[model samples]
Target: AMTVFAEKYGVKYLAAVKCLHKDADALLAFYDFPAEHREHLRTSNPVGSVFATLRHRTARTKGALSQKTARLMVFTLVQAASKTWRRLQGANQL
Candidate 1:
């Protein structure tokens, strides 16, 4: 089916699947996560969305000038992001 689709359309998407096939074991290795946690790990976008704001902050700095500055900056950013984070749908089960 994938071969037929590749022939009909562009091979680009199929090529990506082929690349993933190389790590098929890794890709499929998530089954051990608790069912409730499965949804969260399916994509990094939830945590990543918070970090998107962090990216902007860090992008503005060349690097943390000092360890203390970096630690405080990250702590502050995480606190702010935490307030806006939605509770995961099934988190209570855990």
Candidate 2:
């Protein structure tokens, strides 16, 4: 399948895959984490999600939030949410 793809796509595409192949080990280095952490790390977009929540919260209000207030709001929300966050399966090893 990959050979067919490379043939159809041309040298640029094949070269890109070859480049990635060289970094395959480093690309998968994140799996060194515990199994439980790997699942979360692979699937979750924590930064995007946090910003989405902040965007929704700000959108609900009438006007723009000041820089100080926005910073404080994000800090407060993260602190409150931290209570429900799961610990890594073997975090202490890190």
Residue 77 in candidate 2, Cα distance off native in Å: 2.0
- Over the stretch 1-94, how does candidate 1's per-residue lDDT look in tens digits? 5446556654557676676657667867898777777877775576678778878998899675588987888889999888977667677777
Residue 38 accuracy (lDDT) in model 2: 81
Q: lDDT by residue for model 2 over 14-62, one digit each (tens)?
A: 7867866677788779977777678778877777777777778888875
Per-prediction TM-score to the true structure, in the order listed: 0.51, 0.57
lDDT of each: 0.74, 0.74
Candidate 1 residue-wise lDDT at 15: 71
List runs of model 1 lying over 4 Å from the truth. Answer: 1-47, 92-94
